[model samples]
Target: MKEPAHHIILDAISQSASDIHFHPTPNEVEIHFRINGQRHLYKKIALTKYKVILAYFKYTGKLDIGESRLPQQGSLSFEENKLSYSLRISTLPANSLESLAIRILPQKDIQSLHELFLFPNQFKQVRKCLKNKSGIILLTGPTGSGKTTTLYAILKSFMEDNNYQTITLEDPVEKSFAQAVQVQINPESGLTYDEGLKAALRHDPDIIMVGEIRDQSTAEFVFRAAYTGHLVLSTLHAKDTFGTILRLLDMGIKKLELEQSLLAVASLELLPLQLRKFKNQRAAIIELLEGEILSEAINKQLSPLTAIDFQKLRRKAFAYGYISEENCF
Candidate 1:
């Protein structure tokens, strides 16, 4: 049973799969792997064999094996051929049997800012925002859109400089950095984002990274941290730069506060690149808003001076032959 389980996970890593899905039915279990924004069927196993594999995974991942009725999450580290990988495990109760999903995080896959951005101008704009000593820079994207990866790259850049004190508040602390202090948020222990931010402030951190701004309280706390002369970087879920502003407003943040400390907004989307040019599968294209352009956006002033949006980025990608026409939509 353990041999089969290890084989499945090692196969996923070898294929550069970002996620693996195990859908169990009454008689058998179906397996699928997601790579480069596409999913493909991998294999199937008998229900009897799958049960043993599931039990082994649950126990190794430190999750309660008896809790089949409720959803659960756990994480574990795996090593194969001297390569290290982090696996985030999640199980959900299905109609007949529990379904499992694993997110494969490769420790060696970290990319620098220049490597991640599709355009040099976009990279320059982001660097300018990071240079600011005090302001809030928000990154917006959906899940699997490279938001967290971008944040990590930026944090790594700062860490290398050794000029400022950096701290991060992440839910599960995705990756490890030796230069920066990372705090994992555990609600069970009363360590919420708001509480974590307050504690981080006392350390006189020059830069703060919030894993995400998920609620009104966290949003307000981020703004407060920005106002107090610290650079705050965070991610939000929105479609575009303007949509990110609307989300903050809808979250009960005052427009005046936004106008004062908001430095820039970057909305990112990943598109599959032409296979022949690169070894990696996908790259990020960003829609950026900043400076007077951001002020105009907050004021609802539509002008030609506003920064480029996602639609424009998509058109450029299509024209440059970096992506296919069907992907432009």
Candidate 2:
């Protein structure tokens, strides 16, 4: 029984899968692995068999095994072939059964900005923004759009050159960073994002990375924290770069505040490459809003100009033979 669970995890790692989802029904549990951005069915197991496996995960993740009526989140670590990994496990109650999802994060296998971004210019733009000593840089995108991956990559890159005191506030500290202080947010214990930022500020960190801006209060507090002369990095859910700006404004970020501490916003969309060398993997094409354009956007003066938006980047990727025609659309 342990062998089966171990083999499934190792196989998923070998395939570079990001997530393993177990959908529990009345009779069986259907397993799927999300590679790049697409889900592929793995295999199904009997309800009885899955129960043992789920129990194993719960035990390893330190979650409550008996209580399946409510959602729970926990994490467990693994070491394989000299590489370290953190599996973030989340279980949700469905009907009378419970479904589980595991997010696999490679601790030290972070891709550089060059390898993560489809275009070199976009990579350069991100690197440039990280040079700021103060202000806020936002990465916006849909779920599973590689925002977390990019955030980790850029943080690694920035830490290498600038020896800033970095700190992170994640709902569940996904991976351990040897160089930065990692804090987990557990609101039940009274450590919310707003509270985390306040405590993080007391640490005199030169760089503060919020795992995400989940609500308006969190967003507002982060912006206020940015004014205290610490460079902040965070992710927000939005459709596009322009939409990210509008979302911030709607979240009670005044136009003056935006002009004061907003550094840039990069909206990411992952594109699976057609090139054989990059098979079964995806790279990001970014819609970066910065400089004069970001300032114009602060006042709600964004233009319909053919800037480096998603469509243009996709067209560029197609022209450069980086992506297939199917992805270009």
Candidate 3:
């Protein structure tokens, strides 16, 4: 890669970009950085360097240089000092050649739940769920909402205890944990979510992590795993913790099946830290639905938290740390 393109990648990572986009124009190169959920321009580059950057991604990800007309997906792992990153690369055609978007994955040493700036009791709540012998704990959030980070933290907590065998089946296998057996799913190979779960069962895993419950079969696989005495952790794209149950229902998972196996649903939202005095760190607002309240609510199909209750929940959540008053109600 050219010096300019290489610098761009480093700069984007420094800015905490989730993804980078390169677009070629007549004389200018449009560069976009996805920070948080919004996209902002990093800077315009010369068209020549755009080609170099695109080629760099193609080579690094081992993509067919000629196959840019169709959508191509690949990944690259970069290591600098002790910091490592896995870049997810996707290339598609613009008007002529390929336009590339690269996802920036940051590797940070697993932080203790207490060090996460969570309240001591909040840490207790999280750890309590993890200590359960057999059940499903669902983490719900939109894309780029730090669900993976939270899951990883829980895995780290379990790893330190060395109490159980953990296995994870992630679509792209985002990051690695030293103690867990991680598997990557390949659609082309016909090794799907359900197939992977079936294989995991045979391995006698105490904890199983499925990246996401995308469909009915996958949802059933996860529920079955939990029923069979495995502690399951997974993420889902839902509006709130309550919505996770409805999503499973839509996935053709029966209500009774859900009532028996579901242990907890913790939903998190990422909010900008710039809105408050602290600008260096972001806050996660979590809502956990469980026990009799969650069971009754799900069985009745009743949404428990009203707008007022959300305000109260947020107030209580802030007792944890880093969460600002403005972020809640």
Candidate 4:
């Protein structure tokens, strides 16, 4: 079918496509879309048509169309279906031509915590941390493990109950919420993560969400925001909950400050390819930290105990994903 690059993108959003891919093949060019976290073949199009789509994105989004040596980034919005997306574009070295990939961002919709199928124990801790008026809650997990969705769910809960100024500083501003203000970090305008976070604080927000805490400035600022009485919810790139402590310490946050300001850290993992069930569904197994044990561990600057040993402790609670009665004493 004949379609402009912008219109093709809008059609993908209408189909609820999560990811789009562009690649060249021996006979023809190939396009793929990841739907519901699984990759599916979309269609094969002619080489010239693919080039037009890439040029369209490069030109309209003000990307570096002339530069074949460096990567480019851009975004497109579709108002008719209330959908938006950000694209990352780059040229392949061998072909000396541009290619593209797009990540979808759906506008926010109301979804309850229970709909995610949380274990009772995990849900209780998550609910407690989110319900608190002021504190820093860290959700750590590998990429594509639903960490962002959990954060969105928490924000949705707050939006349903009362009116408060909630702001999120994300690299691409993935999802939009009705009652919250969202800002995109623009490197071209000197709006790095640190800059965006500083701007967020000046707004006197009731809640602040930092997309990812990579360094000392953001880690320290988020902690300070929590200590100063703003509810902070954000994610970290680490193996599990315990590793989150080590990561902050590595970034220059003191142990005492972390213990004082940080409310909880949750680690999650999406089961490997070997564990996926019969249906298209995938499950996230989560580990949560809280209470006195968590406090002492952070205060002491303890390295996370081994996962093998920690899983043994998890055997004690043995219900939900955390602990179960049959496996416990």
Candidate 5:
């Protein structure tokens, strides 16, 4: 049973698949793999064999094998060909069977800031934000838009230059870094975002990374950290750059507090690039709002400076022949 499961994972890795999905039907199990933001059917197995495969994954992932009524999440790491990969498992109960989804995080695929952004000017603007000594720099995007990867690249760049005491509070510490302190939040163990922030403060960190700003309490704590002379980096879910300010305001953060603590807000969207040398690659297009532009947006004042947005970036990409006209929309 385990042999077949391992073979599936190895095949997915070889094919550059980012995720694997298992859907159990009445008669058989459907398997799919996601590669380059597209899903494709990989294989199928009999319903009887799926039970053994599902049990093998649950046991190896350290999930509760007996619990089928509620959702469960677990993660495990594997090494092959001297490269590390992290598998995050999630299971949800359906009508009569459980559906499983696995997200594959490969350390080798992580790219630098220069390689991630489509425009050099955008990279320069982000670098300028990192030079700030204290303030909150928020990265806004939907899931799988490469926010975490950008944050990691920024931290890596800073660590190579200066010995800054950096700390990160993530739900499940994504990637391990030897130069910085990483904390995983386990609410079951009485360690949450708020609690983790309190504990991270005690370590006297010059820079702090909150994995996300999910609620009012976490947002307030992140603001407090920025106000107290610590450079803070975090992510939020929003549609665009302007939407990020509205989101923070909706989360009960005061306008004055945002005015004082916000250094920049970068909203990202990944677009498939049509490079002649490297086909089928993706790059990020960022709508960056910073400095006076950030202040104006937070205050509900509109100006021409706000025109530097995703629409403009998309036009630029199309003009450069990096993307097609249909992709501009």
Candidate 6:
């Protein structure tokens, strides 16, 4: 409803900001844009103007405008320059004032698998991981990492080339896919990641992509689904590749189940490239685990896997001139 909201959206798209943050205080609201894995303050909007924009976003996103003491999350679509973007809006209660966050996601695929992975063979490995028709492949990363983008690209490629039944259980249904059945997680509707997985099994899907493994229930469901002979793809948050194992173990996944149902793990890291064609952009390098190396980790025999981690990834990227020395360790 406000012109400032439209202007902010336009400017954020122009700058390719991944997210927009609004910090409201008693005086003014500080606006920040997250670009290339970092946040920079854009400007400060008056408390009056900020409230109007916040209300506009919440109303458009279909969140409860009357409820602010609790938290809320919803999605809204924005169309500009012949392209559509999905804005995931979230509100949090604060001591001073309610805070707002918006994550901007393009409705369509933007980068290919090649562009996503810095090294060419690593791209090949990701494809190899997907070749198996059973077990789960987990993509681990921190916030602002390329886990979602990488997973979407691979899923699209498979949907285009093969005649496979793919089903995704995302919290908000991030992107639209023509052939695959995408389910959104809504606890209010008696549909959650755990419930969705049970329903997905009845569909005889060739591939299942769980949006994320957030808790023990979801993680157990995912592992059980994979154990039943369907390929499962999901994302997890961890510090690194080995950290993925510890996280899963902490979630109560047994070693034997991992050996049987876990296919591969790829932890993604976004690096600022030093190339001409990638100006002002960053690419992902993965700490890939597969086959024997994966088996070793599953068995708690990580002694031989010392050379594989984020340090190795950064070293390889720096050695290959994909990133500058200053950007590497």
Stretches > 4 Å off in candidate 5:
301-305
Which consecutive 10 residues in model 4 have the weakest lDDT in total? 271-280
Model 3 residue 140 CA deviation (Å) reads 0.8
Tell me model 1's lDDT, rounded to 2 decimals: 0.87
For candidate 3, what is the TM-score?
0.86
In model 1, state the lDDT of residue 276: 78
Compare candidates 3 and 5 on TM-score and give the better one: 5
Error in Å for residue 222 of model 3: 1.6
For 1-329, candidate 6 gives per-residue lDDT tens digits of: 56899999999989999999999878899999999998999999899888899899999999999998999999999999889999999999987578999999988754567768777888998888878989999999998898888888888778767999999999878888777899988989899777888898899899999888889988998898887799999999987788899889889999999998888899999998888888888988888887888888878646344437777778888998889998788
Give the distance in Å from residue 216's predicted Cα in candidate 2 to where it truly belongs: 1.8
lDDT of 5 by residue, 36-113 (tens): 677899999998887888888889899999998999899988789999999999999988999999989886744667
Q: Candidate 3 residues 118-191, lDDT tens each?
A: 34655677778877888899988788877888888888888888778899999889887778999999968998
Off by over 4 Å in 4: 1-16, 24-30, 40-47, 79-95, 108-110, 190-199, 270-284, 296-329
Candidate 2 total steric clashes:
0
Q: What clash count does candidate 4 reach? A: 5
Task: Report the C-alpha lDDT of model 1 over 1-329, residue by residue, as the tens digit.
Answer: 78999999989988989999999977789999988878899998998888898888888889999999999999999998888888999999999788999998887755788888887888887887888889999999987888989999988777666578999998888877767899999989999877888899899899999888888988998898897799999999988788888889999988899999999999999988874776547888898888888898888734335577677888898898888888888
The per-residue C-alpha lDDT of model 5 at residue 75 equals: 90
What would you estimate as the lDDT of candidate 6?
Answer: 0.87
Query: Which pairs of residues collide in candidate 3?
Result: none
Model 1 vs. true fold: TM? 0.92
Q: Which stretches of candidate 2 lie over 4 Å from their true place?
A: 301-306
Per-prediction TM-score to the true structure, in the order listed: 0.92, 0.92, 0.86, 0.74, 0.93, 0.95
Model 2, span 186-238: residue lDDT tens: 99999888788888888889999988898898898789779889999999999
Best by TM-score: 6
